[model samples]
Target: MELRLEKFTKRFGDTTVIKDMDLTVGSGEMIALLGPSGCGKSTTLFAVCGIHKMNGGTLHFGDRDVTTVPAQERSVGVVFQNYALYPHMTVEQNIGFPLKIQKLGKAAIRKEVERLSELVQIGELLDRRPAQLSGGQQQRVALARAMIRKPDVLLLDEPLANLDAKLRLEMRSEIRRIQRETGITAILVTHDQVEAMSMCDRIALMKDGKIVQLDTPEQMYSNPRSQFVAGFLGNPPISFLPATAGAEVVLANGQSIARPRDLQASGDLILGIRPEHFGPQHGEGLQGEVIFVEPQGREELIDVRLDGGGDIRSILSAGAPIRQGDRVNWGVATDSILAFAPNGVRV
Candidate 1:
């Protein structure tokens, strides 16, 4: 089912949480609502599930308008951050609770519960209580419960936040596989950029109660529409340096780079470069003093202090013989650098 929110607006008391936000989740496409805390990503998820009433605008499930539907009537299933399992009930009971609420027969509910347990690979734990299972096992049970009803839409709110790093990675793959196999329209609300980039087809990045940019992970990373999106998407986040733009764009250290023709009447511009973009310094390259080097298995993160007095980070292969206090020359491809205007929009 395709979910659509048009001109959606929500408020708490007097403060608005979502303001004229418009977004559409295509049928059977898994999309993520990604942003930092208090950015209204969670609130938007609830709004779609009909847990929070919109102050204005309309919501649709395909062509049917559900703007004022009650939460219980939406046929939406949710898995929250905490897993929210019942300690007193066995895994079978927990997964069957939704079927019981729908008034399914005892035999039918039991059969469906067994099927869901096997689907999530929790069949062996059906007799155990929530306390007896590992965190990852408990999360699988929760996911099974959410899927038991064959919901029209599946909403996951930071569903992996409570697990350890190793388990989170494991579950990320499992969740994506399950979503693909089921072909259910899924909306994941998360603040982890790597999770969003890895699990979903597209990402809707929100900030200050608005959808700032919506696009695929590759587009958002390779060609950010604004400085905020560029800075927020990468780890060891994209570095910036001040530069003067004109006939010859001059870096802080007086090295000139070819100005992009798309930059309209550039005066003062911010040069954005990813750490991985810097390569071995060739002749006429920018000069910097290496300050630190960190080995990250396959790659090394090298910190450099530019001759012009600013610090930037660069990534090199682990085999590179670069070290601290070593004078190194590094070069960046012109196309790899992004220029942003004073107002934070990309040039």
Candidate 2:
């Protein structure tokens, strides 16, 4: 089902938490509400699932307005961070709990539970209780439970946050696969950038109770609309240097990084360079002294302090002979550079 939030606003007493937020989630497409804690991503999820009442605006599930729908009547399934399962109930019971509440026949409930268990690859564990399952297994049970009702929309609130690193990685792929197979319009609320980028078709990056950017993960990373969006999406994080734009884009240290043709605007600007964009340069380039080096199997993260001033980071092959305190010259990919105004707006 397609989900739409128009001018959705929420407030707690006097302070507003969600401010006239508008989002359209296409049918069968998964979207992520991604941002730091207290950024209102969770608030938006609660509002969508009918857990929280909206202070203003309208919400729709497809063409039907559900602004006042009760949580249990919304046809929305929620998988929480803690995988809220009944400790004493067996996996089969837990998975079919929704159906049991509706008083389905025992045989029918058992068949539906079996089908969902197999879909989530937890059929063998159906006889096991929640306490007997591993973190990943418990998660699977929660997913199966959420889907047994065949909800039109699924809300996952940091469903993988409790798992170990290995399990988190595994579950990421598993969730994406299950989402595709189920074809439910899903919304994931998470602070993990990797989770959002890897699983969701599109990301709604939220900040200050509003969406700062809503786009595909690839586009959100490659073509960020603001510095915060760019900085929030990268792994090692993009480096920023204060610079002035005139005849050339010159760093505070007086190193000319790019020409007029490389920039979209002039005057005071900030240059953003991804760590991988810095490469060995024999000629005109930024000269810096290595200040820190971290080895990561196949590559090294090198931090450099410009000769005159400022600092930046670079990702280089492990074989690179550079070391801490060593002076080096690195050239940035001019075309890939991102220019921004001091106010964080993209130039």
Candidate 3:
């Protein structure tokens, strides 16, 4: 079922936690709420689960208005940061606990429990207690438990945060697969950009409890709507160069100045260049002194001080003869630069 939040507002006393937040999750789509701590990503998730009361808003599940729905009646399943599994209960009993509350028959509960355990690949660990299971195995049990209820909407609140880095990487794809296979609309709240970009169909980038951008991973990276979004996405991040208006951008390297056609009149704009876009000089290129060269097995990361005294970086191939104090010619594609305003907003 699709979920919609319209004009959502939440506040504690005078401070607004979420402000006029609006979003939509299509049927079977996984939308991730990504932001740093205190950005209200978790608060928004809690509001969706009815754990936090909204100051004002309307929530709809499909065509039904579930604005005032209670947590249980909302038919939302939640998996928290810490796997909230019962310690004393065996995997079977823990998974069947929800069914017991629903008053299903014993045999039927057993069947449902086994089905979910198999689905999460924990079928063999049904009889084992939570204590005997490893962290990853225990999380699988928790996932199975959440699935047993067959909720209309599934919410994962940083479910992989507790795991080791390697395990976190492994579980993210697994969760995405399960969400797709079950055709359940899912919402994930996380601060890890990689996690959100890798698992979400679309990510809502939030700041101060407000969504600044909502887009696919590629769109967010290649066509960022805001400077914050551009700086927030990608590994190594996007580069910013101090620029001036002199009919066009004048790099101190003696290269001719030319403004992009779209930004001919944009005065004193900062230039955004991705590190990977720098290539060997075709003719006269930006002159820079290589300050440091990091040799990766596949590629080398070269840091250079531009002739204009600004720092710039480049990604070069391995064995590119890049060393400390080596003079290099860096050529940036004409179409690769993005111009941003001084207020950190993309122009």
Candidate 4:
């Protein structure tokens, strides 16, 4: 189903939590609602599930306006981080509980439970209780329960947050596979950019209760609309250098660099560069003093203090013999340079 939210608004007393939020999830397309805590990403998810009444705006599932629909009638399945399940109930009972509430016959419920159990690869553990299962297994059970009713939309609230690194990686692939096979419209709420980048067809990066950048992972990373989006999405985070642009672009260190056309307006702007964008200056570039070098298995992070500017971090191949206290010249890839206005908007 195509889920749409138009001018959706939410609040607590006089405080507005969501402000004219609008988002669209195409039929069978999975999107990730990604942002840090208190950014209203999860609140938007709650609104979709009908747990929070919108103080304004409208909600729709396909052509059906479900703005006023009750939670139970929304046909939305939610999987929480803690894997909410009855500890006393066996896997079979837990998976079939929803069907039982709907008053399906015993035989039909049993068959449906079996199908869901196998679908989630928990068939062999049908008789086991929640206590007997590992975290990953328990998560599988929760997923089965959510899908048993074949909901129109699946909402996952940081579902893998509790798992360890290995398990989280495994579940990321698993969830993507399940969503693709089931062809269900899905929305995942997570603060982890990697999770959103890897799993979703598109990412809705939210900030302060509004969608800031809604685009494919590629576009969001390579062409961020604002400084916040650029800094928030990268793993190592982007580095910023104070710069002045006019007839000649100059860094705080008094180093003159090629001026980007977008900054031709000539004023003070911030030059944003990712660590990986810096490389050994084989030709001409900026000169800095190496403060330290940290080895990261396959790569090395070289921290340099520009002659007259702030700290500059560069990611280089681990094999490079660069060491601390070494003077080195590094140049940035022109294509990788991101210039941002003083107001935080990308120039």
Candidate 5:
């Protein structure tokens, strides 16, 4: 089912947590509401699930206006971060609890429970209790419970946050697979950039009670509309250096880099570069002294202090014979350089 929120607003007391926002989630496409904590991602997810009332605007599930509908009637399934499994009940009972409440026949509930358990690959554990299962198993149970109803929408609230690193990775793929196989419209709320980028078709990067950028993970990373969007999406994060914009962009350290012809902005600007964009100098480029080095498997992260002032980080091959205190010349890929205004807007 397609979900739409028009001019959505949410407030608590005198403070507004979610401003007037509009969003449309396409049928069978999973979109992520991604942002730092306290950025209204959770608030938006709760509103979508009908847990919180919207202060203004309307919400729609397909063609039905569900703005004032109760959560139970919204036909949305929610999987929480903690799994929220019933410790006393066996897996079969837990999975069929919703059907039991709806007065489903015993034989029908048993058949449905078996089908969902196999779908989530927890069929062998049907007799086990939540306490007897691993975190990953418990998560699978939660997913099965949410899907037993075959809801119109699925809302995942950091469903893998409690799992170990290995389990989190495993579940990321599992959730994506299940979501695809089910073909249900879904929304994932997560602060983990990797989770959002890897699982969702598009990411709604939120900040300050509003969406900062809405785009596919690739576009959000490579063609960020603002400095914040660029800095937020990268692994090691993009480096920013204050510089003067003129015929040639002059770095704080007195080095002049040829400004891109498309950049006609004047006055103070910030140069943004990713760590991977810096490479060993072939001839002319920035000069600096290696200040720190850290090994990351096949790659090495190196921090360099510019000759005059300022500092930048670069990722290099672990085999590179560079060490702390060594003077090095590194060139940045011209096409990868991004110029932003002093106010953090891309130039």
Candidate 6:
């Protein structure tokens, strides 16, 4: 099912949580709602899934206006981080519970339960109780249960949050595979930018109940529409420095030309640079003193201190040589700088 939110707004007494939020998921597309805490990503998901009532605007699934539909009647399946399973129910029972509610025959429910278990790689554990399964196993069971009903819309609210880092990666790939195989429209809500970027077809960046930007993973990373989006949706995050229009924006050890368009008419603008945009500065880049070097498995994060008291950080190949307080030169071109307004809006 294609879920659509048109001017959807929600309020809690004096607090307006989601304001004029609009989003659409094409059939079989997996869309992720990504943002920092209190950004209203989950609230928007809940409203679309019929779990939370909105104070204003309309919600729909394809042609049907389902803003007023009860959650149970919405044909939406929600998989939460906690697994939300019945402790006493066996795996088969848990997966078939929804079908049981619809008064389906036992044989049909069993068939669906088996199919789901195999799909999630939990077929052998169908006889076990929730307590007997490992974290990853329990997560698979929860996913299977949600899919047994063949729900038109699937809402996953940080479903991988409880797992360890390794397990999160494993399940991340698994979820993407399953979503592709099943071809079900899905909405994933997560605070982890990596998770959202790795899984979803597109991302909706939420901030204080509003969508700051919505785009594909490549676009979100390459050309974030705002400072908040840039800062919130990166692994090392984006580095920000106060810069104004000039012939050469001077740095600690080096300098580069300001984007002519950026310098045309600007106030207090920020020069945003991504960590991976620069490697080793040959000659025409910022000059700085290396302060710290963190070796992260495959790469090194080189931290440099600018003469103007600002810090610049970038990723280097793990094999690169570096010492504490070593002066280094690197390149930062006009295109690498993202200029943002003081209001956090991208200019």
TM-score of each candidate structure, all chains considered together: 0.96, 0.98, 0.93, 0.97, 0.97, 0.95
Model 1 clash pairs are none
Instruction: Give the alpha-carbon lDDT of every model.
Output: 0.90, 0.92, 0.85, 0.90, 0.91, 0.84
| lDDT, model 3 | 0.85
Model 5 TM-score on a 0 to 1 scale:
0.97
Query: Compared with the true structure, what per-residue lDDT tens digits does model 5 show for residues 99-157?
Result: 99889999999999999998899989999999999999999999999989999899999
Cα TM-score of candidate 4: 0.97
lDDT of candidate 2 over 1-347, digit per residue (tens): 99999999999999999888999999999999999899999999999999999999999999889999898888899999999999989888899999999899999999999999989999899888999999999999999999999998999999999999999999999999999998999999999999999999999999999999999999999899999999999988999998998877789998887664657688898888889887684234899899999999898999999988988989888988988999888888878888899999998
Better of 1 and 2 by lDDT: 2
Evaluate residue 253 in candidate 3 and report its C-alpha lDDT on the 0 to 100 scale: 41
- Residue 3, candidate 6: Cα error in Å is 0.9
lDDT of 4 by residue, 203-224 (tens): 9999999899999999999999
TM-score ranking of the models: 2, 5, 4, 1, 6, 3
For model 5, the superposed segments whose C-alpha errors exceed 4 Å read 281-284
Task: For residues 96-127, write the lDDT of model 1, one tens digit per residue.
Answer: 99999999999999999988888899988999
lDDT of 2 at 77: 91
Error of 3 at 87 (Å): 1.4
RMSD of each: 1.5, 1.2, 2.1, 1.4, 1.3, 2.0
Location of the lowest summed lDDT over 10 successive residues in candidate 6 = 251-260
lDDT of 3 by residue, 1-347 (tens): 99999999999999988889999999999999998899999999999999988899999989988889888788888888898899989999999998998999999999999889878898898889999988888888888888888988899999999999898888988998899889999999999999999999999999998999999988888888777888888766677776765676864344434666666535566777787877584344677789988887888878888876777777777978777998887677656677777787777
Name the candidate, 3 or 5, with the larger TM-score value: 5
